[model samples]
Target: MKNLIILSIAGFLLGGCTTGTSITKEGTTNDPKWHKVETILNKDQGTFPNLQSLSEVRQGMTKDQLYSLIGRPHYDDGWRPREWNYLFHFTTPGQGENDITTCQFKVIFDHNMIASSFYWNPINPKNGVCPPNIQHKQIANKRYTLSVDALFTFDKYDIENLNTKGKEDLDSLVRELGKFKELNTIQIVGYTDRLGTQDYNEKLSYNRAQTIKQYLTLKGIPSQIINTIAKGSEDAVKECQGISEKKQLIDCLAPNRRVIVDVDGYIEGTPENNPAIK
Candidate 1:
């Protein structure tokens, strides 16, 4: 049944003849001939829908499974427990004709958070399919910030000072990095809280960045593609209240002490190739 619907769509496009009638948003009558011509001339510009992926969507599929099938829903109403809406506009190719097609897919979920039913405006060719946005493949760039407290104790910049939790965090990131095809650049930037002299903080931040880079290199990340930078206390993420006591003041400025790792590379497939973060 699915194959037949796909073949029918293919044949209609190959024939260079439009078959579907276009109705207004209000479902009013329209001159089918003129509406078809207009749509053919100027189709809505949107992400291309993956018909094959959509076909996999079925009743009783869990919401997580649905998201894995379809990258992301365009619009979701928080108050609506049963409905998820996805919007798309794209140009359809048939013979040499290019027509704009716009659609809004409404997915209804049952109480168990499983997809129970769905409907699409404009009557999609593959009504039973689950469609994901067509994300073009390109170079991938990812950046993450790790708090200093998580990686090291206050004022500690040495790799030896990295705690067990910090190692675990890096291990998780390393696993994710394996998903990328070719790693281009890995930037490690360090920042510190504004508690010490400018010169001391600057040196501390630079050492911190270098320590992270060194650790990653030891873990098999190519050192040739890695770059380290020191930001010192230039950009504070949080402003601590002026406490006369120095020990308490440092704790309040903790958020500003951190390191940021930015990785740039090429992914094997589309942007959606990476699974959603758990």
Candidate 2:
């Protein structure tokens, strides 16, 4: 409402609030939120769903203990056999009517550690983000690992601050995965900062992921090695039917649009017991 914003708070934390221009003008910058997500996603890697949570999911967790810690997710949204979705709602700040904060979590399990993960907040929609310092990995079985997000920057999105650090972090992450020899198939899913139509968002997410693929290929990664897709607004971080803030329609949608990385590979023959717990 205050200004035009491109938000991606589906993360567990928030990116720093920095000034950025748009693709339109030099001064009309592109908010670095994309960069912020780039850094975070590139490092840990994977699409929205990470694991099948027990019915009672808690703040601190591990897969082995998911059954006891929490029960199972209320719903499991899986597009395919190996992939699934877990939607979670949580809060951070503010009070009274808007006091409660809500979050949606998407996790994928491969034959190894987490295949990918996406965290969202539909209430505020575009206000949560993660910090670069956080470390993530699978806990139990590699495929069905109990992954955890040591997230920071809870209330705001500081993607602009993610910077080159994000790029290098992700580059290193991919290279590390390459070391696993068993690593083979790869999928790149892209989401956008809230703006545009569902159709446009779908294409934009695809293009953005394709652009990432190009960069990865140039870095010794191969095109034949990866598969890519875009869901546009269908896979949005926040699903909104009505305007929460009419004045800031763009801002409202910022966190809803986003990009993700999904992978299908194997490790240790047994394959990670990647299952959709919810």
Candidate 3:
């Protein structure tokens, strides 16, 4: 009995040591499951439950039920413990754009460990019932942040002539904004690259934020619900140095120019006292 216990302890410690091995393209590690997962993610291709199977998933299903219905989940403990996540990717080498979608299903269990309430993303499932009044999952505070290059022209910040890519990005954001009902304040903070003088940058950043507020207000968000701030050249996410060329440097510091719209308040439909509110 003593020798058997010692062998089990040694085996557990050995398993812990293998978890840190760096994933590689060539399957050289002793862990095959970890290697397979890494390969799928790295290459952006993998198998997941089909939409037909996913449609059968319900709000009150147990973890065991979920496993039975969809085989094993793609084991990820990074997010909430009770949340079951799945990523479905369909691709044909010569077919249309790959349809990659993410689905997150979270179950809140009662004292008896049975599922009580639930929520999920991809809200309107093609064949399944919507998870009984889905609510915006909170993370301390809700923030809708985006870089300036992702919303406006290279150096300009006008809503009328927003670039094609920017328009698509904003459309997605607007859809999410429509989901929330308890928006106390929506702050729009603008930043700029460190190319111009501090005074010039400050004014430019402020103008960008104001324009954003106007755009949002035009889209039905109340003007009073919005706040604007100008970060100017401060807090640059990227400091592009060495290259002294005028135009080249500006392109490199694109990430520094950004505008973040933060929505401060609780979302509608979610339980106020839910322990998973973090």
Best candidate, TM-score: 1
lDDT of 2 by residue, 1-278 (tens): 32323233322123132212122221111232122222322232322222223222332334445434433433322122122222332221242123322333433333332233323323224554321001222222122110001111111113333235445655664665565433334566655544567677667667655655666676766465566777665655555558767546655565644445555432333222332221
The Cα error of candidate 1 at residue 81, in Å, is 62
lDDT of 3 by residue, 218-250 (tens): 776767557899999999888987989988898
* Candidate 3 residue spans exceeding 4 A from truth: 1-140, 269-278
Number of the predicted model whose lDDT against the real structure is largest:
1
lDDT of each: 0.63, 0.38, 0.57
lDDT of 1 by residue, 1-278 (tens): 99999998776554343223333433222332212213332233233444435545676777788778765665423432345556544333231122334555556665556676555554344331222222343456788888888988667889889899888888777887777755656888899998889999989999999988888888887675678988899889888776878878887888899889988665556444422110
> What's the candidate order when arranged by decreasing lDDT?
1, 3, 2
Model 3 per-residue lDDT at 89: 35
Model 2 segments more than 4 A misplaced: 1-166, 240-254, 269-278
